[model samples]
Target: MDGDYVIGGVFSIHYYMHTVKHNYTTMPEPLSCTGSIDSRELRFSRTMVFAIEQINNSTELLPGIKLGYEIYDSCASVSVAVHVAFQLSGGLDPVFNTGDKCSQSGMVMAVVGESGSTPSISMLRVIGPFNIPQVSHFATCACLSDKQHYPSFFRTIPSDQFQADALAKLVKHFGWTWIGAVQSDSDYGNNGMASFLHAARKEGICVEYSESFSRTHPRSRIQRVADVIRRSTAKVVVAFTSTGDMRILLEELSRKPSPPRQWIGSESWVTDPDMLRFSFLAGAIGFGIEKSVIPGLRDFLLDLSPSKVADSPLLTMFWEEAFNCRLVKSFQ
Candidate 1:
């Protein structure tokens, strides 16, 4: 195990179920840890683990060295992500001391994760001092591209800056000069929307209104934004938000007696199957990361066993989803 390297990962496996009444004061219940399961995000986590196993088994990669990993669910909360980042950086205590170095051998060499940019930004600040490398699989906030501020950050996906430019260009090509904008209230949505707005302004596109809301925001706030969208004269609505945020907004929009307008999506929800359920967004279009097939990923997922299920809490959740049964003894 001397040659082993541990990679840290952060993912928003679970989301908060209850409304966030007090954004700063109220602490969510512990049971909120296991909210609605996002199977697609779970698949992303599984793919990462599968890739690590494949690398360990290959003679061409790492040769005699073994790669191990520790994955944490961020729950799509910055606070949760900060705690996990500290643990990954060997700062288990509440206080972070910059003087302390990660104990050499057991220190995480790198981190791959954090599906959203908000959590990634929060984790990056904590892990940056340790000089640990963080490579994100899904984070796309343009702010993360600043090497001067976040020197240790990298990503597998393109930056939101590029996506912003592309989106602006697409709108221009369609001759849509006026539009409405909606964004999630996190770094990913905030920064990405900022970039898009800047680009759109340069393209002479006038936004009728730009509204922002968080996933944990009260239903009334979400409804207010939906009301704005319903009343806006802009025919095109550019939605820069996560699938979770969009889910809430869509629910509110579905309640309204308004007609469907042209919807422009961000990479976050364009490909999400959940969004497909909204027939109102039938003509929605957005940029997506290039799709690629993983050779044995399907078989690996299909070949899950009880032993494998025992190794991961998330896998148990997956099993429950796949087989439509509860594993708890009480349910049994």
Candidate 2:
């Protein structure tokens, strides 16, 4: 009511004020009306699976859209990431003022966090129409089979079988006649330890001592692991644990000089950043995916992408969103 109101041919400020007051007491809050868009970050893993799909679709225009969906690997490792943001306000008139909106939300990535110990018995268990990406490496030693909820699962990390075999190799490399293994109490540890024991027996490797520590043992599990290492006559020890956890365990194990001139870990300790974090881990070796080894794949992706060209702005976005940061590829 900018000083202009009329009632019965007379200026009516009172009438306008009454109307405003009525509105002040009648309307709903503003947060309800503003909730429109919902976004999710689907993990496509670092590779531009989305870009590949786009290219495949574009090529279709040439009478040679021939491959349909077959030309490209539709293997997209999709996991849902959900985040919500909103604003809310309290007002006497039930009206939204200039910054009255309130919102809150969370995001979750569908990527599997550590479950990879289960054995995927066969290949091609299903021929579903939806494309599934192969998980060559898994982040955790948790057995995937126990979940029972997801049958079509794969991991990027080697299984307990692989780690067991590798641990034996490492022990042999050190020329250690006796070895010790400390594994977590969870499925990851149990399975990993069992595998190591089996492999050592098969390879004629003497496992002088083996111990298990509960991942949730309330106490310093790392200290327990260290205790096993000390009591054993083994000159080499195998530790199966997460990178961050392993660092702590190593620090504890290093507290006092002991036998086993070398400490070997599974692929869990192999990331470049993790290796560089502690100088003491300089000589640590583990099975890890060397992206450089697949420079060809990176090169091919770059060549096909006008955006990912040398010094291109898209290159930063691509790498940032893919490596470490997680791939949330939305053209927007």
Candidate 3:
């Protein structure tokens, strides 16, 4: 904003509304990797602070009750602005603490957009591993109770820890002898892969190779993962990347004369209507995936609202964004 306005913090139970008046810089950093996303030339601020602020503006532009807002200056990177905000938060408390950055625990909802580094479902602890929004939900899994707090921190997604156990059971059931491991470079990826490895190894399952991809770098994400599958001693490859990244890898693998010995996709690997527009992940597999679950998860997610009509900016952004993309194709 302009000069001095006291906003120690911000608090909105379900709706996130903020009037951000700050300078945002417009500079593009483009990178490529084999991961799900091909290449995005995002303004540096969009990743963290800028992204939150944009969502805030979008919330303003698009009014909603369940919106998470991030405020920032127009001329700064998300990291720089966040560091400044964190230091700033020490002296004063905000009116709202979206998920992280403030200790006032009540209930916070984390929107899983880009399962970039790890599957959003994999790592949920916002405070521990990554100190990101994911942990806010995880914190609820601990001894603390959100019932006691006003703006409690809660995660709606199923946990990867739980997913890992289910997947490991599936692996054992199928008698899969070996698996290759691929992950995005983030807490979700790291933790999920670790869980996968632990589960498989406990069952005497062999991990062929473990590889990680950078979210910001897409150039080699696909190729390296496919290459690992092609050349590795293992058969199935466990992935922590998003469906977008999975689509790319699967499409590229389909292109190869040879293919992975067998494919084991995370639950994140699912079909969306817009995913097919790019025509990447077709022919990757038929409708044969072992299902995983979190007990009471579906009910829990559905229970987020007393009715289906409860407005959510984050959900609107998600489906709107998804609707804008191409759905996953069955074949070329």
The TM-score leader among the candidates is 1
Ranking by lDDT: 1, 3, 2
RMSD of each: 4.1, 18.7, 13.1
What lDDT tens digits, residue by residue, belong to model 3 across residues 152-252?
23343455676676667777887876777787565555677678788878888887688877434565666776776788777566676554445556566
Where is model 3 more than 4 Å wrong at Cα?
Answer: 1-152, 251-257, 271-332
* Two-way TM-score contest, 2 vs 3, winner: 2
lDDT of 2 by residue, 157-225 (tens): 545676668777777666766767766554556777787777777777787777766423444666877
> Candidate 1 overall Cα lDDT vs. reference?
0.85
**TM-score of each prediction:** 0.88, 0.48, 0.45
Candidate 2 segments exceeding 4 Å error:
1-136, 139-150, 156-158, 214-216, 254-260, 290-332
What is the clash count for each candidate, in the order shown? 0, 26, 57
Off by over 4 Å in 1: 1-3, 17-32, 91-102, 328-332
**All candidates' lDDT scores?**
0.85, 0.42, 0.43
